[model samples]
Target chain A: MTKPASSHQTLNDAGEFAESIPHEKLVRSRTAQAMLWVLLIAAVLFAPALLYPVFVMQLLCFALFACAFNLLIGFTGLLSFGHAAFFGGAAYICGHAVKVWGLPPLLGILLGGVFAAALGYVVGSLAIRRQGIYFAMITLALAQIVYFLALQLPFTGGENGLQGIPRGTLFGLDLNNPLPMYYFVAAIFLAGFLIIYRTIHSPFGQVLQAIRENEPRARSLGYNVDRFKLIAFVLSASLAGVAGSTKAIVFQFASLTDAHWQMSGEVILMTLIGGMGTIFGPVVGSVVIITLQHYLADIGSWVQVVIGAIFIVSVLLFRRGVVGELARMLKISSV
Target chain B: MLKLLLAQGMLGLNNGVFYAMMSLGLAVIFGLLNVVNFAHGALYMLGAFVALILYSYVGLWFGMSGFHIGFWPALILTPIIVGGFGILIERFLLRWLYKFDPIYSLLLTFGVTLVLQGLFVNIFSASGTPYPGMPDALKGVVNLGFMMFPKFRLFAIVFSLIVCLIVWYVIERTKVGALLRAGTENPELVKAFGVNVPLMVTLTFGFGTGLAGLAGVLAAPIYSVSPLMGADLIIIIFAVVVIGGMGSIMGAVVSGIALGLIEGVTKVFYAPAANTVIFFLMVVVLLVRPSGLFGREG
Candidate 1:
């Protein structure tokens, strides 16, 4: 069966097919992409100056988190509902590592990523046992188990979480200052984004996309679909861990809020709003959502109501998402 | 020790009714729509809320604080109203997304879940208000020789079992159920046969969600009515669905109750593991049988 045109922009492409498109649109899209990158870099450099550095850091952290999530939903055709376990679980573990173990900030962050990878390996190994919606449900239930453990286990500090996490020096630069910390987070976000970009364009990524488009076809072609999916799942989880680990140090705290199912929902929202399957979608999505949250924090649950409304609208009318639609309008391969 | 075991088993059975009802509703919806109704839990919570309003707010708005809709009428009335909302959701929202990947429908229902759950939390804070509409006939305790059980809980268990049996019989043995099954297998063929496939789908969704409402009404007096009550339970139900597979009516019913009883037994030995024991079981089940115990390989 042919995939719907709106599911992802890449649905139009059938590799090794003889349909030749005009070259002008490709050049045009490339130029447009380059311009966007320049604009984004400029924004990152100047956003901290205009906005609170800490707030900018929060956006960066969530942006990276959303990107990691998009790698699954947007690229791999897997919609995991339990990403918060990696994000929040890492926050708690990284916090404990840096605070109690007195590890360097870099090492603690790495340790958090490793922990998330391991957690992802176990969760993903079982989750991949089922396909499609069952996969989503399995991940969600497993994550709920993790949340329960975080609440019940002694090290997670229960509801208060792992409080007073130190933002130790990374290469002699004290992380206490907002400016230095912002740059540090920016660096991590860039590294994570680049890794995702490279992965999506790599040979393995092509196989993932092949599986996403048609798993049976890919399997028939002698591909080991399950192993590929497990690896992709682990990759996404570790990056989410990096985002959460970085957040742990930046905020100097880890709490149940990060580990909660609501956080998982928020990441999904970010990916959907920005544009699923678009390279730059989740970054833009996270910025829009976090900014709305920052401004609307005082209105209480209304923010959630509004976000929910936005999600419903996006699903019904704008499934292409903001970046997805924009790229479609521009006839660009990338969002 | 045996008496305590029986009591816990009874309590576990009470919890199982909810699980069975919820998972059964989800399986029914998924069978036809190919959409995993993520909002099934929210709809269950809505059922309880509907019963609450009928019992309390409806009377209060009419300026009779003491006069309330009895526990009996509310039980019948709640599902119809909740089922109406389900029909509206199917007609308006769920109809548009059928041509796309099933995941989008899951996402859409998830959005609906957030909206319904968020609005309720806003109106009635997170802390649940206990339902006070239990009938006098079902209040207090009944001795079954081995243990004394709350009459309401006993009624809930029996009522749910009866409802489950009725539903199973209708689906497995009736002519209309044959149409529902035909529709699930090939809607286009069913439509060619002039069965009104879309209408069948809409009503099926309504019926499934109505079951959720019925379960909710049964649970209102047992647990405090709260917006947050459905979220956690839905995840567990999803696990039950995973373990039971989505295709089998009996599988949904049996696995849900069995897990609840297993959890109760665990609670007796080590209370801390009770909540997570089902999830671990799910993991083990997946390793042994990926398509679930009763599920055909997808």
Candidate 2:
């Protein structure tokens, strides 16, 4: 069980195998990265012309939310079923600050993120006490508490929700305009994506992966496992908050739906469908799901049935997810 | 006020019966499958819907005037039907998920839940449907001097208690119960003793989900049989499971009733807080004893 040398050797072997693939062949190869950048730039430039800005903005928000969720589940091996607490909780806070307190959009969003981080600290402290399945249930139960609080709180507007929030100016630019708001959301998403990328490649991320792979071994190696998990939890929650805040501004409203358990389940679906533990998986997953929802809106509740079927199929047969499968087929390992 | 309290306590105990039944299923399923059965709520809803269909449609098909199968038959039949469904789910869907991380099973069950709920919502609109109350024999309230208790509710409470006790007895005292305990502790060892562990696992899941179905049938008359009924009650039951500690049969039973009573009392004193009191208790429990009231520390 304490075969540290063999485990380390296996890790090195996998690393070598990854490295053996030529740079151009790798999924995140320089040319591939350049192509992705070009595609992203093109999408940002052309998507608004083809799609509604609000729709695009919503997709981006969910994409970022899924990515933040992936940070914990994929990298740190913590499957939280209560992420809507951060996502929806932040949305409410940001909406309240912007609409009532007259804060600028950026400040409001930041305030929401900060609040989510604090919430993460408190929730993570307690939840991290349990491992695996219990952890998921604990987060879920706590998130339900948050949901109830949202329903009861006057500021949340109860069932009606916090509606008609003004999309305040960002850096003196009126974000009420679609193009500016779209670009603003796009920029925030890019920054978030990059930050997640950086974090996963960082030393802290290395420790997290180690813990995910073997918690007991990681602990035996003298790492503070709980602290690492808590930090990852906070980071994931804060990023999720950022996505939620941006969503509140883009929509100019925050509703109880944002903080719902179903929303948490939706994020999980997005991540799982895209690729768990892969950098681009959640983005791809969110895009596919949001796009499906956009087109299938006419079907009403049938969409849920389809989504459920997808979840079952994905878990049973396509566990690697779309991007994860793509990476495997391409013979490239992606973080 | 005292009478009101007594009435609320009875209501609470009634709700507790459902909670105990649901959580018992959850604990049993979790103990063997190691999956949280996120679809437990949906299964509960399915149970009620099954009863409703059996009452309405089965009678209609049989061409009998008002031959709706009432509470008594539903109590027996709903569990069998739902438990059979559970067996199918375990055999086909959940079986494949065992090798993967427990989260995948959760996700799979969640997907199943969504599908179940969606189908029910599509069939019978989201609004609550009324199931007829107890038959003529069980109609009327009992005057207990302190307060009046509905005969149907009293029957439900007593029936659920007996069911809970029988499950406890079977799982704790009987020979099969010993095998189940052994299987839960070490399936491999149990298998070495020639016990068909996998079959036990499937049956355990069926039994657990059967309990959920029974609760649904029992709850149909008391609460409006809505598509969202199980979804609504499930989160609270999850809290109960957490408070009692998952996989603890006795813990689920005791805490389910205890929490229900607590919630009932809270409803009388402060109506607003009633919905959230159990969650608050859960948080406090976590802070004080992370493993829960009856759970052994890992």
- The candidate maximizing lDDT is 1
- Position B253, candidate 2: lDDT: 96
Worst 10 residues of 1 chain A by lDDT: A1-10
Per-model TM-score versus the true fold: 0.97, 0.95
Instruction: Report, to 2 decimal places, the DockQ of model 2.
Output: 0.53
lDDT of 1 by residue, A275-294 (tens): 99898999999999999998
lDDT score of residue A150 within candidate 2: 91
**For each model in turn, which proportion of the native inter-chain contacts is also found?**
0.69, 0.67
Which candidate should be chosen as best, given DockQ against the real structure?
1
Worst 10 residues of 2 chain A by lDDT: A1-10
DockQ of each: 0.62, 0.53
lDDT of 1 by residue, B1-298 (tens): 8888888888999898889988988988988898899889999999999988888899899899888897899899989988999999999999999888888888888888889998999999989988888999999999999998999999999999888888888888999888888887788999999888888999999999999999999989999999988988889999999999988888999998898888888888889999999999999999999999989655
